[model samples]
Target chain A: MIDLYPTRGGDEPRFIDRQDPVVYGTAEDGPIDAGTLAGFDRDGFLTIERLIEPEEVERYRAEMRRLGRDMRGDERVVTEKGSDEVRSIFEVHRVSEVFAELVRDPRVAGRARQILGSEVYVHQSRVNYKPGFRGRDFYWHSDFETWHAEDGMPRMRAVSISIALTENHATNGGLMIMPGSHRTFVSCPGETPPDHYKHSLKDQEIGVPDEDSLTALAGKHGIELFTGPAGSATMFDCNCMHGSNGNITPFPRSNVFIVFNSVENACAEPFAAPSRRPEFIASRDFTPVL
Target chain B: MIDLYPTRGGDEPRFIDRQDPVVYGTAEDGPIDAGTLAGFDRDGFLTIERLIEPEEVERYRAEMRRLGRDMRGDERVVTEKGSDEVRSIFEVHRVSEVFAELVRDPRVAGRARQILGSEVYVHQSRVNYKPGFRGRDFYWHSDFETWHAEDGMPRMRAVSISIALTENHATNGGLMIMPGSHRTFVSCPGETPPDHYKHSLKDQEIGVPDEDSLTALAGKHGIELFTGPAGSATMFDCNCMHGSNGNITPFPRSNVFIVFNSVENACAEPFAAPSRRPEFIASRDFTPVL
Candidate 1:
């Protein structure tokens, strides 16, 4: 059905029947079985235990290191406590070959197309670098809440594909998601904390969710931690209530993040009061990925 | 100036000023320097020594072997002299992660966008398997002739980026290109040679270039052979007249090929007498690369 209150372009709300087993297993090439699709629809996200091969993992890891350090004037790399270590690298695809390949990968983006059902574009590409002891906790919130309020995203016709560049686990503080919480939007006092790495967060961006609401949601639907082998991938809906804990463990958890938005449902003009976030944080170009 | 007769969409002719040093060095991300752009504009192509990293090369080679052997009824792989060995793999990006990654690699496809002056799409992709002695010579002809006369490409705004999985050399039938031949379109007696593997060559296609014309052109412009180390990449214009000789050396030359066409100047309706080549051969989807 068409979205009556779309904040962005001419895209209507695109929701898959959380009960559809048929959509998950069906792809033009590669093996994404029917059971997988069913699980993804029922939950807010689906995890492919091993989406990347060993060679690719090795290559990606090496490239990520160089991107976080060697790539000069690479403004996207957010640091931890003003130190040299990287917290996250937003839009690494723009600077490196390896991450660029990941964003448009058929195994990753093809599944996105299966769910979104149209040509999809990369609204954002990021690398969450949860280095050992350096990684901090991310506040609980739905991504769409911030995107709609700050970036002018119309609806939730977007999926975030995260591939593990390093082993993601509980100790390392991998992403923790609230299953099936994407059905409704939660309104809260969203603000950009001053501690944010430059242009990383914006005003009206719901970083810290209300404790009462988060507690109620957690009581109803338990959280699921994204923990897996290197190269494992997960596709989550944009509105999925999610966050990650602090990584104090020696094992660093770094993952490549690619946000695929349906071409018809691209972001609109600036809705935030001050100004829109930079193109790197929230892309303006809506060219669809094949 | 606009294309007087655009094929399908309302796309006009888009040209890159060969004299403009600014176009190459100013990508949002990645190193597409002025020297590279100048080379591409001057010689009708540019070859990057090591675009694919060693790990990616290893991964792609491994995947290509399995795909050539195990992937059954997947008809894209072109075979040797009726042997099990794969001569070429077409539309590989649709099937595997490694190849998919290669097709969209920013270092490669990003350069394509630089020349095409718009979002680029894969018009066709194939790996040319020039084995030690089994490989055949691809006769001299321009790709644009086949694409324009047969595939109905509206203009010469496409570039093919070929990455060498194995070291390509003069002895191993490395690509022979006529520099600056892209300036003119030659109408030749193009036919589908029977010796060509199934799904490799098509009817009403230009394969053999006129000898007199070829000799005259070669005499005037001279030829350049693309011989480089493994992981090397070359981006050549569609209208560049190119072909290769049979490999007599022991070193096998197998390279992954990706043809990127500007979305605006994509292929129109097939002009061939028979049925149009399938999507696997000539993809109709014009979704741009991210």
Candidate 2:
């Protein structure tokens, strides 16, 4: 299994050789292969080296930035800037073919299918761009709060993918993940009463650490920051605890996040409420595939 | 809003007012108007009196018993006689014309549409039969877990409907609900670990409550215990806390449950990954209707 954390000094990210192409051809074979999937089942998240060609990553980044600039003028974009500390171009998946192409990419889809085992569908998609020195880091939280309200057996969707269009380094403030945090289901404050649920990790308790300190803690428990060049991507279970620091680099940190789910796991309606756009409603259908 | 709990102790179980055809009609001034949706939302759950005629309910009950008997010999049916305390026949919506008619019932469908505010689709249908003296009571819990996951927000589906095929009363274990429970989210313990995502009523601890105590709690919180003769139906929010007590009477308690979700909020997959179903796959454009 790919060790989630490498030795302290060797913290620099290294690329692993791609596995042989399977029934569904994609670089996903490296991260979601039999071995990787088994590891993810136990570990909750996995990062693949060079899942996309470096050039392809560069192209996606350039195209996304252009789309983001164009969307700024579109009236449909509802900017919730300070709330999340990041500027997002909402509903780009509906208007931009580039965004649609990334979501429908066969490589990503194949990995999702293999992981979920059931027919899956696109629940939603978004593009987030973090301008350097412009925002506070996002709070650490799980993504399943709105969807799974009824308590029963645990259900999981495949890891949501965040493709780094820009090099995510210490200066650019890449994503940091808590290893084994998926096992810690922290009740979201305010969303539900604290007495009703228990939270293992609190936003106030997560102290920001330098690269050296991060590597040290990560080495001890296999926790690590997802810092790599522009072409790399990180795939994490939706339930895993993850958040990133603010970008302090010279350039803006941008990425395209495409979240997918298994078809058998139908989402609640309020979770996928339609955008105000008539076109979005015209094309979007909420029926479960299976 | 029709008050779920009338201060008067003798308020009889209200059946759908079929004689006032407007309430049951398709006209703008229908008896069961979608505008009544606001009332249903405030009340948490509502019963449409006489949703099915008494004769039809008898026929359905008889048919279910036959199906249960036939299943005793079928390998696919997993339980033995007497061992089958609570037998649920699945996918009746796809197999039974009666279910189809009920799903399309405008009086029911229109109200569901307004509450969910989306084009709704029948997610699944089942017949639950609780045999007299041999039936097991279900624990208090919410319904959202089976239909959706935690991540997808704004809940796609709004409510679930249980149509009574036999008289439901204290002796036969009618449904019991915790009022105002839907407003708050509680985490329950799951099979994997204590922290696994589970939702329940916050004010009450998890354990089986005696019938008298359970009924009293419902009454205290303005909760409602739905008791009625054959042909009545109760509709409740997916997140509401509810369950039934064992039948103490001589007769079996039987009901047909038809769950629907707004088509716009319908998901191709249920959210949250339970450890039991570890399989995950990427979603595809497999929604039957879209």
Candidate 3:
């Protein structure tokens, strides 16, 4: 079998052309029509102004607060390094019913199924709680690189949806994805140590794309900062080069992040890592949404 | 590899002793404890008094009403034979967010995971709406028989959870399962037609255990009728000889039914049928619940 989009192997990180098609589904398969499907295929990402209503968004925001407050002791709750601030709550949907309902929402899961051209499962879900001043910056990286090397994802057949719980302003650690950057798969240089997710979830160091590769990508495809009101959402390809700055502003930036992987593309064994990460970080469940 | 639980090809119906373990998980795997797990293994099914709270039950009751009213035109809504009254709403979770949340609830999904020893997906889901006076009886048969013959489910590695939206009384067509009958695999005699589900969902005539086989099983293992208050639930093995009677009483019996199949035990090509059923009745999607 041919292994497309190989990563986390070489001494120097290299960029390879993506082998898989960007959009997998047709107009008749799901909610996405031909035009929108074509746009997503070209851009590698699509943003919506209001994927959820105000009342619904408020519910998720409330759940995020409760998860941050009540689940601090849970191992799935990753805290910011050197502080008590909750950095992220992995598998948020499992812990909170409000967030669980959001995952089942047709507006969310339906779109993922439409884009993936098949039934999809939640590969990972987290509430990225970036407090006003304490939130640290997430460096530039391709999610597929980490997923492939550490979690044993066989291909770039996953897509991530980030639903903003708070207003994502340009200055307050909003996501910044390079346009057309998803076409290239950047093989990161690293060895994924066993149980690396324990430290990496708090602060990722390994499996990061090298500076030269990042610079070249940034130069080729200009960075696009996602700024929108609460309830706004963005769906991006798994291999897209993306990251966000630290929130120095008073407005806290928080988003409900969910990754959807095709049922056909279930993880096998870790391609480069010594072992697989915990299910809360990189899920092994392959049940499709009903 | 040995086909442990084989079915749907013999001229005469016969029972084979179960080769798979009844309870696949230990206490560490999920919510079901040692004693409870053992109890489920002894009997083919287990009943919970308050699987969900009264309020949660009401929400499902409301959703059932909404689905019956609104989704009557949808192809997934199966009607009672010789009547316009809605019989069952197949793929109810996909059509309603409220029912969708119920499927994701750990109380529901966790128990399935606990019993199956692995991540599970919704093999099939429906809101069985047996209306008063007009409802018809479901013939005695094991779900795995039809699933194997028509849907290509290879083993009894699946379980069905029925949560009462309305109070389930003994006279109101409550589910009746033969205790210890799950240990026997009745090889159903018949060829499932190409579009068997179109008729079977409304009224199944094929892939049913013959009267002689059913009589022998009923004589050996005694029938137990499930009667419980609203919010009460039952989890039963896929191969259990079970069926419900017609509701002649004024009280209507409605329950949210969901089937959880182990991701590893996904369906393949049909074992006996001309073709596989549609996704609504026999789901091809094997994405596990988060």
Candidate 4:
């Protein structure tokens, strides 16, 4: 049986210690990092804290945010309706030096290569800033919902890395996740009743009570809250149960969400959000920003 | 601006009417229907009510449940750790006539075709039976979290269809959806604090008023609960915000969720699920079950 972190309440939540810096430059010869890969296979989520230097984090955060704001204001960009409030910045690898550097970060990409077991490619990139007071709190959901097979392939693979610019904690509405929730794929919920809090589905229910119950259950199940200082990052399975509460902190909670996938698995289409034009791939000879 | 139906609290969500039924009669015409296509684009989801007959629903549900029970007994079919639940019954799709029929349902295929605007194929098929009080509730989240692209194509195209065999209602625990929530791709919230609910990312302090607060914000934005009669189903954009409440009812809330995509946009490799085998194809000619 795989060893897992004991649940706070009785639940067997999967947890792995953040990757150690000493192992950052470890040789990749035989058998991928067993511990990290096993943790990922079991928990469907893993974290490599301080994947990048503090200086690089600050640079990427500042420049990306600026670029994000600029793209959001561009009128030529036909923002999809209903998406006006939320900024959808794309293809930063081309425009931002910071992004370019980070995408090729050896530490990040190397680990990704080991885990993915394929030739990785930058599938898509974006920066989302949920501004305080006015920022939106994303509901609970998964990421695999949009992908479909085109060339007869059956499965899709993706890895998402989020770099926190601001400290992520309960006060700031850091992420709240359910342990081992990725094991199942649940159908999307439809509308809710007036007393939505009292609302329940055939399989489950959600409200203050349900939330509290799940929270308690999560604790009992060993689900852990991922809190970290700015520059620290966490990587979890795309199917993992994760979402953040509203950022109740005075400052904005900002993060750069970078998603990568095997080139064979990602689409060749241009970034769908800000632009319909395909993203440019650096020639094989060109050096990656990293 | 897109025309929207007049909505009332507790009333069934409205659907844009189509002059023609989205149907597929030929292989060359593609799979998804126009109505399904248009609905998915506008609402981020659509449903082909009664795509399968009642008898089919019953047949598939009973057989799959029996198979699942048998699998569980033999311990060959792995149940998600911590919970004695098997998420999707993909293998059943191979053996069950009902599942195979639904997977090849022209209505569904046609809609997927329209959204993807290309030839399409089935990515996976399974029975999602949220059993009695024991069933777990999936949190609000998006589908793109895990999907990756393939051979330069996007990871997904079109919508996911769930054909319900049993009545999905508040009593039985139907689906709860947040409309217009798909447009925003919010960052994954890491670990959250218990008191985080009291605070808003916009506001840093705890004890925020319940009125017009973030939780209330979702309500003001309003959530749509999908409660439909048996044989009715719903489909939505992969990015939409959705989650279900638990089965407070005594009976099992069951449905078959069949996912399809534009053949061009699916991942080169299927995401690692029980159904990830490359030979698994839901198309009629591709791999028809006797």
Best by lDDT: 3
TM-score of each: 0.45, 0.38, 0.50, 0.38
Best by DockQ: 4
DockQ of all models, two decimals each: 0.01, 0.01, 0.00, 0.01
Query: Of models 3 and 4, which has the larger DockQ?
Result: 4
| Per-residue lDDT over B205-252 for candidate 3, one digit per residue giving the tens place of the 0 to 100 score | 788777778767766886677889999999999989887655433457
Better of 1 and 4 by lDDT: 1
Off by over 4 Å in 2: A1-290, B1-31, B34-36, B73-82, B150-156, B191-222, B268-270, B274-290
- Candidate 4: where are CA atoms >4 Å away? A1-290, B1-37, B73-87, B95-97, B149-156, B189-221, B269-290
Candidate 2 structure quality by residue, lDDT tens digits, B8-106: 122222211111111112324334455554445555677788887878777787767766775554422324234644356655655566666666777
For residue A168, model 4's alpha carbon misses the true position, in angstroms, by 31
- Among residues 3 or more apart in sequence or in different chains, the pairs in candidate 1 whose N, CA or C atoms overlap within 3 Å are A24-A37
Interface RMSD of 4: 12.1
Candidate 1 residue runs with Cα over 4 Å from true position: A1-31, A190-207, B1-290
The CAPRI class of candidate 4 is: incorrect
Of models 1 and 2, which has the larger TM-score? 1
Candidate 1 positional error at B52, Å: 61
Model 1, B92-201: lDDT tens digits are 88887777777777777778887777788988887766675345555566776667645667666788888898987544567878788766555555343333324335
Q: Which whole-number lDDT from 0 to 100 does residue A191 have in model 3?
A: 77
